[model samples]
Target: MGAAQETRTFVVWDYLVFAGMLLSSAAIGLYYACRRTGPQTQKDFLMGGQKMTAVPVALSLTSSFMSAITILGIPTEIYRFGAIFTMYGFSYVIMVVVTSEVFLPVFYKLGITSTYEYLELRFNRFIRLCGTFLFILQTILYIGVVIYAPALALNQATGFNLWGTIIATGVICTFYSSMGGFKAVVWIHVFQVGIKIAGFLSVIIQGTVVQGGITNILNDSYHGGRLNFWDFNPNPLQRYTFWTIIIGGSITWLTIYGINPAQVQRYNACKNRFQAKLSLYINLIGCWAILTFTTLCGLVLYSRYHDCDPWTAKKISAPDQLMPYLVMDILQDFPGLPGLFVACVYSATLSTVSASVNALAAVTISDIVRPYCPSLSEKTLYWLCKVTSWLFGAICIGMAAVASLMGALLQMVLTIFGVIGGPLLGLFSLGILVPFANSVGAFVGLTTGFAIALWVGIGAQLYPPLPERSLALSLNTDGCNLTSFHLKGNWTTTKGTFSPNAFQDHSAERTALMDNWYSLSFLYFSTVGMLVTIFVGIIVSLLTGGRKQSIDGRFLLTKEDFLSNFDYFKKENHISNQQLDMIEDGEAKTSELSQPITLSTQSV
Candidate 1:
């Protein structure tokens, strides 16, 4: 009991270290997320004026991917499950390809202010709202989980109160998000990404040195039955086979690259079609490199501490805490390592939290509010953003608590997002792929893809894994498998020999199978969603007599139904500029000119 408690304990300095870093991050992020700038229009908040350079974009990719759960949860995966989980790094290939071929071109072409507007343009208002609602809801879950993970880590390590951690993090994130908007979010993303990778790579090297050498670590992992790389089994239930990789891998990439809120927000930030493509291409290398680096840490953990026996030690009830625990285990001898790790995790959270709040602010203000409150002013919109950011922050913290109590971290992550993301992707795909599919047909296809994904995802979760599988999938829902080495403590850690499990024990429960054939791969989820949407959309169009929207080539905007709204900002700008010019020139202005009023500023 004493040893177990000691293993999970923390120091006062650890608490202070974590708190100080977080406070600094919040201050910096707030400074960036909400700073006042030129025009202060809705487009600036929603898409950062589509003028972001590759540096911030690259960091944004890093920050978005390496959240608390990802930082800690992924290493835990490698510790318990072996090589299958490491395959996640390869997903960048799919991301780059899909972003290039499918999503970026359309989003850049449309110039959409609300990514969801395409849903309305392609399908109808219901599907558009549904898609937007799901994006917001799932993003909340994602942010919440991302928020909860580092807090959980700190709580376990230093005995900081969990609720305190939650609220503290939430309040600070809200402060920055309410102030800086997208520009702040993007700059902080750059900072967070740099710190996170430096911290991550440092541990990979240190952990390797601490556990004997890299060679010893490799030997232990290989000898412990964790080094196998192939699962040639043909069964669909075999979670990590080559076929699952091809089919499921494709789907995972599609949702993230094509439709997920995090990626879409970034995609819409590109200044041009080529830049969007270039950013994704840059993101691909970074994605693959970061994932591979993190995955290697997993392998290294498997090699060195195979003796510690994470499950038997009961350091955590689930695999999510493995990485944090592993860090603490090593940090027992080293000062500042844990602090650095915590800082890195916080960095990852910063990227996601700020991005999420900004995205929600944009969507709520642009899609839902703009449609209704057509007369909203910039001053009113900014205040609305403050209120909206605070509200979303509260909701996300609650969702994070729920995620902490439920299934495997990965499973919880996917289940919360999968049922809806596919359809959202499809709806967007329909607008781009099928020019003739009108609003009504798009709406139908969106619903159909969602329903199909839900049914399929549920089924995959409940299905059992075959005895020996091949490849690890990118799909959600606790995808990894753990095979314990020390059943009754028979295997000698010194000699590195192990006994096999009894094959006759077929009656015993073997695997935790959940429904949702992991479409975590890059192409499958979006591809299927797209195929279903295009097919259903065309059919619905034929049935309902829908037609191509008539607009001139010059009026065609990638992200917005800009033909109408283009006239609005342009017209308003012309009038406002003319009015300002006359006032500066000391000439009498016409009665038609609206007054130039100062925008009120409030500190959150």
Candidate 2:
């Protein structure tokens, strides 16, 4: 038997108990899907009858916000930077205040199903389609990451194959989400998040109480250098800095809460404008709480195993696996504790999966399928939403299995999301702020923004790293070892390592330029990408000039967007077709001879 199997840390009882809990929750999800009735229209299917309460909605938001990333990625940030990651946690408050004040009201008033629909209203159809497509793509990529991390943990714990775990998780999620629709997803999310929080918090409390109180954790952390603060370097290459956090993080926050389709679906779920905004803040608060436990747990784990060589653990081939690896070591004496922690990882992952399934279904149905088939019935829409959810789930599973060949899962996911999502933010901003930005200018701005972002994202990868640093620090091997992947001896078998002979092959080999330039610098991926996007977009917008007619102040309800909602504004006034017509309304004469579209006389 494999050493993982031989170790058998979890007893039969533990397996049975955990299985029961998971199955029961799954049963609840199935029930919700089976019983779901009434309106399955775009509003209800995507938004949850538009009567969802603030609390569950908030919880659901938090649940979606956290994925395998929150559980595994943050600790890594702490492990890499010590206490500096605290900056990331506190950044949430800033995200909430700014997001609540600037963007919510416009979204609420516009009655948008997909956030990018506003881009179409503000910009041209190409930008709208571009923004919507990227949102879907980014969300799918993130969902794949969410699935991959948990599957990795389970693979290590149960001696299961990693690919098998990925497929299993994807299939199970698809079954429920495909059948249950949004109702199934939200209910499951509520429960899954609740379990995740309880399990994570309990683990933290136990680790703290057992390890001589929270002070010990802090003291250990301080000595270990996890509490690092203030990287005052003005270099743009640095990854974390006050400026980057405020600017880039704020942009990310805006993309998520202000314009991302995932949160939009949640807002659309609420019955009232107040409830929708209520849920937004409530979610911010919940994320605040999640950060607390996850951070504490991270410190505790690090303090306990500060002396351990994480890289040496055969199971710790990836930095993200350290949490689960530590959980195994931490619970060596307590039979069920490992199970509990594993359960927590599963819960967080599942909540994320359910939420993604829900969001993707909404986007696929409302943005893609609905536009094509306006005559489809509610029941038909319901089935289509469910089917699309399953389709997306399958895509995510396939991507998760292939993620191994990509860049670091964490950095790759964020960079892709940032590059694509950054333009969407510009689109939303233009929609609400630039009254004179006709579809032409909007389109020009959007194309320029995206082209700029694309250049930074793709071009940056091709750019040679610091040529000087390549000579200073480099590692090369003539051959591979059977350590990280192959388990030659047993679970107890020592992990594989680079043989000393490998370096003999090329001690003089030049290092990659990335190693030279990639450090705690401000010139990171997001930094370069954001600057390119905003700069190009603004310039393009200016050069293209303005439009006729003043946009209504009511439509640009910056702060009021969220504080109030479009739901109470009456159905007829939902879209400003008449108001929009007032500007281009008279362009009939100009467009009469120019029916061919080209940033001129758009949709008159």
Candidate 3:
């Protein structure tokens, strides 16, 4: 066993910290469940009565966006691939603007529950059901990785039983989320996000202080090529370029903010459109802060063990284990600190899983169950919502148990997002932006996108090439006085490398379409899928006798949505009256052709 496993133990104070986390979450749930004003109806329970302020909702949105996979996986990413992942923070600005200006107004103004409902309005029931099915698949895959990530990390840090931790966290999150509904989920999120930030900052501070200082950490990481950020390569097969992280990542975030039920639910929970918009900006800031802190944690971990590569030396079993190992290494002597770190991981898991459960429940109730059982009472619908939430939560737990074989949590989550999320995002984009896209086009486009995404996602995983990394900083124990930091006598750095046969494989065909497609960087999955869907959707719609009448201008974010905001530019440019009238007339045609297809109008 490695030192990490040999020395792993949890103290009473650590358990107490974890207990406090669980109890407080349950207490909040119980409190909300008891309030007569709270969760009395389906809308109240699912939508938080539509009275939430910007701050709590913003925090909740932030927590949901950055799950345990991020908390654990990002640091590992930085440690392994350098700080290129940090570029994702830049995409938040694009996400906020697109969502607020384009998507939020549409969802908020329309007063819809499930965002997929908009699909039905713009297209047909087939498209709506397709969108909802994609969302369910995306959330289930994501939440499983989210729950399993921290549990796996905690097991590494404290020697806790992995299955027990997964069950405990999943059951606790499900109970609170089901009982208390959105309000309970939001408040608990606020609390957990606070702990998460504090826990991360503490790690960075302690790690930096111990590693001489921030300057020393940066210098060491810089020398090791771990500070690498810019990659101008336009090749789609190459990972972590500026374009992929920014452009591709923007599409990824748009999927989360624009159409995701978890986020759209928060948008509706707010007091009005303005507050909903405000929460997005707040969430953007939160994303920036968390990414910066975790990036620093990665740098500091590299600095502390500059000469001692954990994975190469077998000091840590996996890259995902890096953060947990770093915490135990640095804070294990300080009794409660290790527990606090474990609690931080759990906090991330709970917030993400709870949010997903709530969102999944909302989608299942609104999109699937209600459509089939129109005669059910609102009260009965509310009970059904809880049952569905619990059911999905249980399924998520089962998925998590199976996630151990999925490799690294972060890569797995992102790949899932690319495969499943892209299609759903394409469906929404088709509805909101393309006025000519019909339901048949959307259904065909979405199916094609999903097929391509899954093929590449699974194929690349099965044939994963050895990931290229720079280990320019060689290992030594000059900074270590502790004997445990030394490599085992039996361990040989050149054990595998010494054999010439290790490099003998040459079966790959570089020119094959399958090879080229599968070789495309994981970051490009969503972007490629989205573009393919849009292109296919447009072609199919036009080829199959597209909409003769314009879609309702309200359903789509046409020029009218932003024309008013850009009045100064239009006026300064001296735009002609004929041009403006043509734009206005087109907008009017949309309103003439479009009709609302809300839940009230549709059969249950």
- TM-score per prediction, in order, is 0.78, 0.81, 0.88
Off by over 4 Å in 3: 1-6, 469-515, 563-604
Cα lDDT tens digits for candidate 2, 76-189? 556655655556555677767666556765665555666665565555556667776777878877777677766665565555466766776777777776766566677777
Local accuracy by lDDT, each model: 0.60, 0.61, 0.76
Could you give candidate 1's per-residue lDDT for residues 1-604 as a string of tens digits?
2121233345566556666667776777566554555566655665675677555676676677667767776666566556665555455576567666666544544466567765554445666677788788768867877777667655554455767877777777777766676666777777677778777877888888887787887787777666655655555545455555555555555666676656777856754444555667777777776777777788776765565555445434345555666677676556566777777877677667777877787787766886678688976876787688888878887887665544455544555455566676666666666566676787788778777766655444443223343233221212122322211211123111111111124454543432225323222444455567668978997688766455222222333323332233235446465555553343422223422211111210
Candidate 3, residue 404: Cα displacement in angstroms equals: 1.4
TM-score of 2: 0.81
Better of 1 and 2 by TM-score: 2
In terms of lDDT, model 3 sits at 0.76
- Backbone clashes in model 3: 2
Stretches of candidate 2 exceeding 4 Å from the true structure: 1-9, 37-39, 312-315, 454-531, 549-555, 558-604
Tens-place lDDT per residue, model 3, 422-529, is 877887888788888987788889989888888887776755532342222244544343425422122233121111113323476534544467667777788877
Per-candidate clashes come to 57, 25, 2
Model 2 worst lDDT run, 10 consecutive residues: 470-479
Q: Which of 1 and 3 is ahead in lDDT?
A: 3
- C-alpha RMSD of each candidate structure in angstroms: 9.5, 8.7, 6.9
